[model samples]
Target: MSTDASGGEATGVPVTVTADAAREALSLLEGEGMDTDVSGLRLFVQQGGCAGLSYGMRFDTEPEEDDQVTEQHGLRVFVDPASMNYVGGAKLDYESGLQAAGFHVENPNVESECGCGESFRT
Candidate 1:
């Protein structure tokens, strides 16, 4: 995979991370105090959101066989092939503010988002 300021340019990489998100991810990973080489962040889309789909992310030490792994700005991100359809081409950002604080996803494929902004429909 070709690592860029935005994210990796890999064939199966479903989502891209903004520079802000990448920096924040690196900080968060460091905060966990795990070996950076083996630990990474995993992003996925799952069923059962108010709008039919929800996004998920977590730190993982091992990746599944079907996962598409990419590294950018010293952060590793993994995305399973099955979740790519819904999140492909999406951009991830990290925002810290009084109103909202966390990772945000801007997905081009989303047709609608729920009122809470926690779920989406493709």
Candidate 2:
């Protein structure tokens, strides 16, 4: 992926991965194994949740021909065209603390996120 000051790519199907997040993702992928056929993590949005749309991610073994792929910090991320509209220029971050430990998305396009923090509205 092209490098930029903002994080990674900032245009069309763009996604930036922090080094911490990339390490976490790589560890998770390694646990899934070659037998599971997981090539990378697929990021997308689904219509639901309290805020109208929920972010979803899962292991993807096969990527669609139209999928936009980006490699950052040694981890591969896949984004479909439809989801790109909502998550372009977003950053994937991993946080670990006494209260919470998980992956969080920092999306510039989001106007607000629900109280539960599971969904967002543009």
Candidate 3:
């Protein structure tokens, strides 16, 4: 899978990953025994949740033919065209705190999110 630089502005990548997120993703990929060069995290939007849309993510051996792949801190992220519509200009971040610790998507496209914060509506 080909990859563009982390800068979304230069590459027109829909989503960008924070340094913390990239580090966590790379560690996860290594733990799974996936080749960092060929494998990546897939970020996509799905129809579900309390609101109209929700985000989903998983590890992929490679990006799909139509995926927009971006590289950040040596970690690759794959975003599909459909998902791009909802997540464009979004930031993927990783936070480790006493209350929460995981990946989070800060999407500018989101108009509103559900009370539970599990879903969103554009």
Candidate 4:
């Protein structure tokens, strides 16, 4: 994976996005068949979930000032500074199977998660 802007990981945080995972993300977006040239993919953590944290991803057009951007598989990824702690040392992957498939986040910092997999607590 390549860092976006300044070209590096968070000040004290570590994260990795494998090449295969990146390609898979791009593939899924293409398969979605949207009439859009998605500028990139963005990931963030938000509050108010049952587990205290939730992961959010979107196909975006640009980066925000506080975004820690990263690029992989020709797609830009934006992550907010505040979400760094909640997702520290995490990795994002794309999975596919007959029953399920999508972007999956493997976060080491998450301590607890709701049964529905919609929220997490660190």
The stretch of ten residues in a row with the least summed lDDT in candidate 3 is 1-10
TM-score for each candidate, following the candidate numbering: 0.85, 0.86, 0.89, 0.76
Q: What is the lDDT of residue 95 in candidate 2?
A: 96
Q: Can you list the residue pairs that collide in candidate 2?
A: none
Error of 2 at 40 (Å): 0.9
The candidate that wins on TM-score is 3
Per-residue lDDT of candidate 1, residues 4-121 (tens digit): 2234344644567778898898888889896677677888999877899999999987566666777666777777777877777888899999987899999999999999988999
The order of the candidates by TM-score, greatest first, is 3, 2, 1, 4
lDDT of 4 by residue, 18-110 (tens): 676778767655676632243556788888688888999887666676567666556567777788778767888877889997778899888
Clashing pairs in 3: none
Clashing pairs in 1: none
lDDT of 2 by residue, 1-122 (tens): 73222344434847889999988988888887832233767889999989999899987875566677777887778888789899988999999999999989999999999998889999
Tell me the lDDT of model 2 at 42: 80
Q: Write the residue-wise lDDT of candidate 3 on 1-122 in tens digits.
A: 23433323323445788999999999999999999998999999999998899999999998777678877788888888788888878999999999889999999889999997779999
The lDDT values for all models are 0.78, 0.80, 0.85, 0.71
The alpha-carbon lDDT assigned to residue 28 of candidate 2 equals 88
